[model samples]
Target: MNRRFVSKVLCLASVSTLVIGTMTGCGSSESKATSIAQIKDELVASTGAMAAESVFSRGVYVNYAKDAENPDKTYFYVFNGDGTGSIEDGAADTSNYFEYKIGKKDVTFYIGSIDPIEEKFTVKSSEDGYVYGSFEDGLELVFEPVSDVEVDSFNATNYVNEQNGHDFVYHDANGWSVKYDPEVITVNAGGPMTTFVYTAESAGTNMITATYTVDKNAEESIKELGKALGDKAFYTEGIFPGTEDVKGYWVVLNPEEGTSGGYVTAMARDYMEGALIFEMDGHFGEDEENNMLVSDTLAGIVDSLTFETK
Candidate 1:
């Protein structure tokens, strides 16, 4: 992937943690400890109905903590029921953590700042049995399972040529078709993943835009292809945009003219089941309709994604 895209993704992931920390009341040592203990208790109580043997096999809940000086810096301690526990940090790793028995099965919990730019918390098991908690309201999380298909089985040609092949379409609230195009290419390697790309075209009077989706597992292959395309390929960066969904690193790139706007926004979610990526790029033009059309097009595609198990 492009270096710029990588940077953006990482930045978003980091911001997410900060947002989560604030949301969970990690602003002070006392509040942080209290919130962490309460959350752990909730998990234990929710899983207590299961058999003791099953419970022992499951992990124990440990108190979560935040940095003594920096309220936004949070960490979680997970016990293994046998008196062993592991510590997780918001700065280092934010993806997977210890699993606890919620019912008959063991479910993993993740923590990160994902809203208001600086809050953090643990997600609870929703109706689907998967944890779906978020401190920020605007951000969405999609988790899909990795398919059994081998990475070599993915055909880049077929992927680029599909009828709906990485297409982005925009519609107005009035039900009018504003603009539509399929201009981006996406390739996947193995697990659940997604990517984002932006492209635009100028019509006689308006500008048309398209945004592409790339899977997380597809990063390796995409990077390779990008290299083959020469120095124009994407690269990773240490900074990201926005406050919610902050991460340790991000991926970013400035697309060539006629391709898309100078800036592109991208993010990736690595889950036990699979992974998903979200991206957004705007089209620049004098016409307001063109800009609106491009924004709506990218937003629509992003809103349509759904997560499923393999």
Candidate 2:
């Protein structure tokens, strides 16, 4: 019932984080991590004093574990500067506190005689203060600075309590967030540029039929794209309102397949000095309702989006 209109603006996002001293690495099954001493050597050279404070000092960490008391569940915790830490056990809808320290890449709880109720890390420092330690089993883990922004998982179910309200909600790994109705759209599938793929109930809907990408080469790419699109795409600087400076505009796209009964449109948004880019396409039936849905609905969605860029 809805004709198709391609979303034009593709707002990209770019963001970029923490943890631990050590004991023996966690269970033998986990990843075998580089010793803490080695990590320190590599970290200190470029980072200098900032990284001198071991990841063990303070921060939040996320990890998974399975044992007698705790099944293989993921845990998120904040290790305070005072040596005390609080952990969240979502299964129980509860949280607990403990004392912790890293012997190397290993974290021990309570005291010397106590086995590490926590786990260990196979330490790898991608940047200065940024540390990624995979548990021996290779589950992904992150140590986030306490001051970093956070968001509920973008895929959180019941995204909108109202059945007819926006159905899909997303927070990119970096905490940028957005919501949309799933009955009409899909998300990013594979990736190089497009981080999300979306679809609607239009006959023109074809997998890979539409595209979206977050271009790290944003500025050059956008400038190149603007030149290519020529007069068809114009800039409306400061498109994002109430924030720094956000601007975007629409392009009346050409028809796809036969002009039987539909139209396509493309919208692109440039932000974070083009470091973060987002582009979306929409399809609408030949009806005004679908047309309105395509334009108004998407404009509102883009206006409400919130994210941080590095």
Candidate 3:
């Protein structure tokens, strides 16, 4: 199989806004926030401003609901104790650094040192703790606190290979390994299966899951699955690079041209335990133009994967 590689570089644009008259005092949950200026005025007149500082600066916050609506997009924002902060947009996979000013009721974000965007700070209590909610452009955006370790990984320097720009590195106990960028993909490892997810902007989400099987060699296991899937898909058998005599298989789904969602590839190879089976699936909406782009990105990751028999 031929492997295709993909790389990304992002550029940020500045946006500006103006603030009107300031309002003062803490409003109840029943009251709707109008503007950041009013919220700032209230902070100046009350003692709650101090509390707001602690709340905003205590931890990193992420747009929890963005991934559900647009799997390819998620963003994070955090307030530094010194009125400085940053926001990372997952869609573009870029970080925008900024200086921030906190008022009792809202925080103003200054991007590019010129554009001042004001957002109302209404802290809502959830079962998991407190989450900050803001109303912007008719959408009630909610941000929840994430762990410090996860936030640390969001930094570009924290990745596996800084010079090469690879963001994540994983090695299983069985001696298999893989490297990929966390900004464009994420992994969930547990039980007998590991899942990798990639969100393609405007196209859809791609998920690849691998399950380990003990006592079954790669060729035998794949053949069994291929027989069951028969004619429903196309299959190719081969050997992975750097491997000796061990065999592997690749299966691609066959569907109509206008199919909304389907499997892209299913493959497996011999490993320390027995075999590591992988199934790739794509979820595309009405827009499918980016399907090949998403597939190639995911394929690049799989190509980087290496397996060893302990």
Question: So what's the TM-score on candidate 1?
Answer: 0.23
Expressed as tens digits, the lDDT of each residue in 67-179 for candidate 2 is: 22443333456566687766654333334667865644444555222453655555543243345556567765555443342322211133212332534554455335565
| Sliding window of 10 residues with minimal summed lDDT for model 1 | 58-67
Ranking by TM-score: 3, 2, 1
Model 2 scores a TM of: 0.39
Q: Candidate 3 at residue 195, lDDT?
A: 83
Top model number, TM-score: 3
- Angstrom error at residue 30, model 3: 82
lDDT of 1 by residue, 1-310 (tens): 3344355446655655555567664366766566656655544444422322232232222222221232332333433454333444423322232333333433333323232122333333222222233234423332211223233232222222332344432222222122224553232212222233334453222221222234334354335434554665465633222223433133445546675344444544343333334444444565668666666665655445433221
Question: Residue 115 of model 3: what lDDT?
Answer: 70
Name the weakest run of 10 consecutive residues (lDDT summed) in model 3: 7-16
- Cα-based lDDT for every prediction: 0.37, 0.45, 0.59
lDDT of 2 at 160: 17
Which of the numbered candidates is closest to the native, going by highest lDDT?
A: 3
lDDT value, residue 309 of candidate 2: 58
Relative to the unseen true structure, what is the C-alpha lDDT of residue 281 in candidate 2, on a scale of 0 to 100?
Answer: 48
Clashing pairs in 3: 22-37, 23-38, 23-42, 24-42, 25-42
